[model samples]
Target: MKITKLQPTVVAVPYRSEEVWAFGRRRGQISVLLEVSTDEGLVGIAEAAAYPSVDIVLAVLDSIEPLVLGADPFEIERLIRRIDLVGTWHHVRATNPAIAAVEMACWDIVGKACGQPLVNLFGGRFRDEVECFYYVARADPDEVAAEGRRAAEHGFRTCYLKVGAGDPRTDLDRLAALRDGAGEHIGIRVDANEAWAPGTAVQLIKEMQRYGLELVEQPTSGRNLAELAYVRSRVDTPILANESSWTRYDQLSVIRAGAADVLSVDNQMDGGLLNLKRSAGLCEAAGLPVVKHSLGELGVALAAAVHVIASTPNFRYANQAYGANLADDVTLGYGGGIESYSDGCVAVPTEPGIGVQLDADRVERYAELYRAEGAAFAFHDDQPRGEQAPALPKR
Candidate 1:
């Protein structure tokens, strides 16, 4: 069917609990949802990442509407290339997320038309359920350790903790506490968010080995491939590269340098599901296991990830599906609204076209939240001095 319209809207949803990271504290997430409607009355849905800002995502989506409005939803790659061509080279970095969301909607439409799940389009299903990890945003050692225990109580096998928030001692104490609290059975992985120097990462990681870290992700700046390689060589724990790579060229550089032992892949980062599959294929060919990244996404994005990871053969690490941490969700009727976590894993969506239907009432409610409170909302770096640091909440 021919494309009919591209609709974009903002929604603000509260977090189930407050989270603190190196950046700051926040209690909710804001995301832009895009719906692509076809001539035959089918609508495809997707959500874009709005981390640093949501305005950027909206502007990109609005600017690219012309490129997507009249195209065939099934000719996904052609539509993507057209959007890229019109927007120019720099546009890829700036607007690929918007394009990625639109592409996902197209895939949803395609899946519905074919009467198949998105997993089938991603090279068939590899497993019925995909494993996930509980995320504890950067916090004090005791708080993080407590969350780790809760993760195990909730049946998670792995706990993902944010690191590099403060001094070396911060991470050391946090890791030690998490290991003790989570017990010996739970696996712990830490993400530094490119906050450390190679030297610092090396020294700290060497010490963290005692706690049995599953991996240390993106310890150094993503651009410093040589440094990543050096850290990987010096450390016994596997190094996972997240911010360092996205496109094929970036992957090529990382592969050539032997930068990291594993690569973290995200649908939005790679542009769309097809690109994600291609990126995973590259990692698979290189014999590196792939891990999924989370940006505190909601159900739409989380469902998309689950379908992709479930179909991927080398997705060894637990997929980062942090939507479960959200206090409420806007979509429903897709395996408990994509927050169906139990025994450390979530079942893949079996229904056609990503298998999620929007809860109209919730959407309107959150959209109202966006309209009324969007301007007042700002991320950690955006807040002024005096109001910058908020106390982390205790469970």
Candidate 2:
């Protein structure tokens, strides 16, 4: 097989509204897409899950170019794991996604070449559709209620609300409104996004406990690990680790500390497929539930995540996936609803090679929007570097 260097392209898709978190908030997210090419006119593509910097996405892809440029397209795992000799943990986060980009691309190539679907490579399918959840954060208590009502009306039995980062009074008020709007039929899940402290979290969660909510994600602040564990001990509600659970060892830490009852792992942010696989295996071994977390990724990684979620039998909690209310066209022909539901459960997709394809023209249009949104151009003239300190002495 022939190898062609991959390149980074930026795309921006509009959110119907925005999903607020501990980090400021935004109405739209920038997407970075990497396209891999091989001989016999086949193509594979993957997208990084985070947008902290689109350049990081490109830098990652560029860094792995040398390792994958001349390799066979079918030796996916061997090449991905072999590159670990450079640095497993560090490079896994930095360069592995770019490598996953290539791996995903190669899967597409080989799947098409052999007329086999991607799940065949993964050993076969266990799921046909992935269940989904919808996020609701209007900041207005009434609006929050309205959003909850809409979710329920749309047949979404679960509501993922954004709390914490706002005023405490607002959080409580909105929680009340949300409960009322969803009534007793809907599952209520709150994501604090790590906006509160241990003590306040205990108090607030205790109040939220009265509602018999589903789970609280990162209720306490993320900075203090000890306090996180303490908050877990204090609350009766199940604690789902968001900010704190990033690795296999992290899964162990959460279990050992008795901090989290469930784990929400973002495959892209924690790293790509390699780390996600490792983390999933770890969670399975530990007998803990897993919730798929996505950073507003489009079809590629989103569909990849569906495959992973389906493959893992122990990931019983609802996965934080896209209802896919946003994509004009998806990798697969299917679209995720605003949230996943049937009897109020998400369904995993069964398609070949992640089951989604990017529209080149649409992606290009978003790339232009991303450039306009300023992924590479920044002008910040007034940020402190550090306090004045003595210079280092020459060796």
Candidate 3:
């Protein structure tokens, strides 16, 4: 069937707490929900993280409408290639989320047409459910400890916290508190988001290891693989690559450099779900484990990634998700809040396509929220400290 129309809605879903990171903070998740309607009456659903900005994602959708309209939904690879080569988006990494949303919608359409779930089409279920970590927003030591206890109490296997946003002493205190509160069993993963320097990373990781780190993510800048390798060599804590492995090409370089023990992959960052699967395969061949990364997504996008992760092996670690932070979701009941998770795992949907349908009322509510106060939800911090640029490696 031919594609007919593209309906895009911007939504802002509030977070339970502010998401504090190395660069800035956000109070919620802003996503562009896309619905691709086919001429044959099939409608495929997808969501795009408003990465970089919402305007950029919206502009990308508008620009690719001509290339996507009238195209066959089943021809995902060809369609994506056309969008990349013909639309001249091959070099623009920022345009990926929008392109990925289109590809995800097409996969949804294909799954529906074939009367199969996306996991089956991708390679059947290598796993029945996908595990995700609880994201503990960066906060005071007490708050961090409380969140850690909450994650453990909820039966989560891992708790992810953002580090490198403040002084090394403060980060150390938070880690100690988290470990003390979460207990010895719950694995703690820390992401620095490329905020540290080689020396600082090594020193800090060595100190943090006292609390038993599960993984140290992008402790140093992603631009220099050598720096990552140096820090990795010095620290006993395994380094998980984030910005260094945004695309398959970057992943290969990271592999060649022997920079990391684990690689972080994101479909929105790379362009599509198929590419995400390819990323896993590539890392699997390299004898490296892959963790699905997120730019903050809603149920639609979260469910799409879950299908792929369920079908693929080598996703040995708990993947990233925003369930612990999202206060609500636009989808009926698939993937928002800790309540949606059962022991930190989300079961793959058996229904055809992505398997989760939007709740029109909730969608409208969030859509209006986006229209009214979307800017506040963006990846920016309103705090005065956020206005002053942080010097990298913050020694």
Candidate 4:
């Protein structure tokens, strides 16, 4: 079927918990959604990772529409290539979140046309359900510990805490409390979000070893593979490369440098599902485990990630998509949808074409919120708040 229409809508939804990032903190997220419809009456839906620039991403959707308007939806590679050729520079870095979104819609259409689940297109499922971790978003150590215990009580096998955003000593203490609450059974993974220097990361990660860290992620900046390698050498914990390895080429560079113990990639950063698969393939060839990084996605993107992760044999780290933790989602009808966190894993969507149906009403509700309030109004991560302020003591 020939592709017919491309629709873009921006939505702002509330977060279930306070989210702390290296750059900011927030209680909700603003995301862009795309609906790709074909002449045969089939529509594929997807979400793009657009933070801080919903309007820019909306404009990007308009610009890239011509490249795939009348093309074959099933010709995923050709369509992506044509879109890239039209404006190669636009696809660089996380700026291509829209490109990835459109590509995902194309895949959904192809899967629906073939009457198969999207994972089957990627090489079929490797596991029945995709395992994930509970990501603690609060800045308080007490809250962090409580969340860790709650996650374990809910059956999660791992807990992820964002570190390096504030005081190093306090972050360390928070991690220690998380370990204590989670006990020895739950795996603890910390993401520094490239907020630390090599020496600082080495010192911090070394101290964190006492609590039994399963992994430490992107302690230094993404550009410093050598520094990441240095941190990796000095610490006993496995180092996961997130910001440093966005694409397969980046993965190759980090792998060659012996910079990381694991690779973390996301569809938004790497371009699309195929590129994410290629990134995982590179890690597999190098005898390294590949991890999926969530870009605060809603159902569409999270479902796509589950499909890719299920089909990827090298994927071993806990899958995450904070949308699952969102108080409400703009979509519905997927087997488990986005709020399906249970038994420590998410059941893969079994329906055709991303296996999720989008709700036009809910989409409009959030879209109105986006229009009236503006994207920035929905962003609360710009500054420290509540327990995040006054910088608490360590130990």
Winner by lDDT: 3
Per-residue lDDT tens digits for candidate 1, residues 1-395, read 79999898899887666666555567678888889899999999998878558877888788888888889999998888888776674454533577789999999999999999999988888999989888776667788778778887888888888777556787778888888888999889988777787888888889888888898888888888998999999999999988887676677689889999989887786678887888888999999998887666778887887888888899998877765567788888442222478777887888898888889998999999999987544464536888646332100
Lowest summed lDDT over 10 consecutive residues: which window, candidate 2?
A: 386-395
Candidate 2 stretches with Cα past 4 Å from truth are 87-99, 221-223, 324-349, 374-395
TM-score of each: 0.93, 0.86, 0.98, 0.92
Pairs of residues clashing in candidate 4: 25-381
In order of listing, the candidates' clash counts read 1, 18, 0, 1
For residues 312-377, what per-residue lDDT tens digits would candidate 3 score against the true structure? 989999999997899999888889888899999998999999999999999999999999999888
**Stretches of candidate 1 exceeding 4 Å from the true structure:** 89-95, 333-339, 375-377, 381-395
Q: After superposition, how far is residue 76 of candidate 1 from its true place, in Å?
A: 0.4
Model 2 C-alpha lDDT per residue in residues 1-395, reported as the tens digit of each score:
87666766767766666555544456555566777787566777777644456666677666667877777878776676665565353544434345456666776677667776666555565666556665774467888888778777777767888776435777778888988887888888898777776888888899888877899988765445687889888888888897777555566677777678888776665545546766877877877888877666676766667666666666676677554335343334433345334644544444456656777677777777766865332222222556333221100
Please identify which of the two predictions, 3 or 4, would achieve the higher TM-score against the true structure: 3
What tens-digit string does per-residue lDDT give for candidate 4 at 1-395? Answer: 89999988888877777688666676666788888999999888888877447777888788888887898888888888777766664345344788889889989988988899999999998988888878888468888888888887888888898887556777878888898788899999998888887888888888888888899988888897888999899989999999888777788999999999999987887679999999888889899998898778777788888898999898887876674457787768431223476667877889887988878898889888877765453445444466444221111
Error of 2 at 289 (Å): 0.6
RMSD of candidate 3 to the truth, in angstroms, is: 1.3
* Candidate with the larger TM-score of 2 and 4: 4
